[model samples]
Target: MSNIMETSDNEILFIVKSTPGNRQREPTESDPVVSTLHNRKVYKGDTTILAAEFSAKSSVIIEWKKNDFTIYKESPQYHAGQSILIINNVQHCHHKKKYSVSVTDSKGRRVSSSSKMKVRRDSGSKISSSSSSDSDE
Candidate 1:
């Protein structure tokens, strides 16, 4: 018996000999499996938190990206993300933006999950109410 698996641009093949009372063994270092990032909705200027849970046999590196662009850890808006990513002061520019998180294990196997941000205007804000009135004039 044989089976093939794909991970991070690499393929792995497994071959098993059929025998009486023989059982398949578990893999020692399986690729990291990550959780989905659910889409979020927040008022402008609010804080947002995005998290991706993963399981791996070895330590892993976590990275975050926005709209396919890398979001550096040094960015003011970016907080820690061993598994959780925080973005503070969400603005209009963040509306509809796609955010992704990648997890890479020691073996260089990587997987990613993404979610979109929906930023909404704060209806209670005076500035938003005044802007709507002005636009109608």
Candidate 2:
């Protein structure tokens, strides 16, 4: 017995084949598996994106969180799954912040991945001072 699963060009394909005397169960909805989430560094006032990728047998729900608090999609910072989490005009307050992405499959199985954001102050923003004094000639 052989089975082929149809998938979109952007989706991964899985093929299963079984021989006589060897029975293989058909695929079913499974938990989403996190594929990637990497730490990112960006300069203050710049934009940064935290992307998350997953693999599952069925559709899944994606959610983003910061410091364990859910980040609503209505917020301008959220750009949905395509970008996962987009931070515009990053600030020092966001430095060392932890961001996570959770994916839940139809079966209720869920998985998560997290990454930290490192914000660096722009060199041009640094303040420098110089003083010069001359004695009476």
Candidate 3:
């Protein structure tokens, strides 16, 4: 339990009190709050990260997918702490693709969000070579 008090100078103070057999409270079967999915554009061969943020008091399951294919669902790739999906050294193959994340709580409550990834060609690369010699008539 906690109490809030106001001083004469308009300063607020909080006092926390503990009781016997008191434990932390947990969320009760409420739908998870998920962040809005935003589209991203990046240059080819660039590193980018896709994050799926959510809030829940209980244990939840998270899954990351790309074009209906599963990814980062296991260890070394799945980061449950920050709820983020990482893509290193992005390439043209990742362009114009759909990425999504789904979260589910123990009570069967679920939430999901998806966004499209757009890739652009690098400006520093040349496509063709120019010749110095010209035709004479």
Candidate 4:
């Protein structure tokens, strides 16, 4: 059998296979850029909506915060959505508060932006109250 295998008339076949190890690539995302501009202005007893937008290569989760605290969705006072945040009634309590939106990818990449709300008195008077967490504006 060995001599027959070695001879040209009889042949034996052997097959081998190899594969390179796969390398995992790190997740990447661009800095979250807020598309919503123009500070919203709403008088007392009026509803106002704030919207923000951004793009990323991977799936991302979005959130809205007021003064660094997470806002609940569809709450009586605050209505939060994937891209839009709504304040039911503009009131003194919300004036000049820092409102921010953050986008976080599944890989833990995160970016955020913030702005202050300007709540005005419904009465036609120049006297309006303003407050802020910091004196940035």
* TM-scores for every predicted model: 0.58, 0.57, 0.60, 0.55
Instruction: Tell me the deviation in Å of residue 68 in model 1.
Output: 1.3
Alpha carbon deviation, residue 131, candidate 3 (Å): 44
Stretches > 4 Å off in candidate 2: 1-29, 73-83, 123-137
19-111 in candidate 2: lDDT tens per residue? 112112222455456545666656677555555544555555665667786653211121122324555556677445777777676677878
Q: Which pairs, if any, clash in model 4?
A: none
lDDT, residue 122, model 4: 62
Better candidate by lDDT, 2 or 3: 3
**What would the per-residue lDDT of candidate 4 be over residues 15-130, giving only the tens digit for each residue?**
11111222123324544333443444556665455555455545556656667766532111111212555555456665457777776655667777777766666642322222
Candidates in descending lDDT order: 1, 3, 2, 4
The model with the greater TM-score, 2 or 3, is 3
Off by over 4 Å in 4: 1-33, 36-38, 73-82, 123-137
By summed lDDT, the worst window of 10 consecutive residues in model 4 runs over 1-10
lDDT of each: 0.51, 0.48, 0.49, 0.45
In model 2, where is the ten-residue run with the lowest total lDDT?
128-137
Give the best candidate by lDDT: 1
Clash totals, every prediction: 0, 0, 0, 0
Query: Is candidate 1 or 4 superior in lDDT?
Result: 1
Candidate 1 weakest lDDT stretch, 10 residues: 9-18
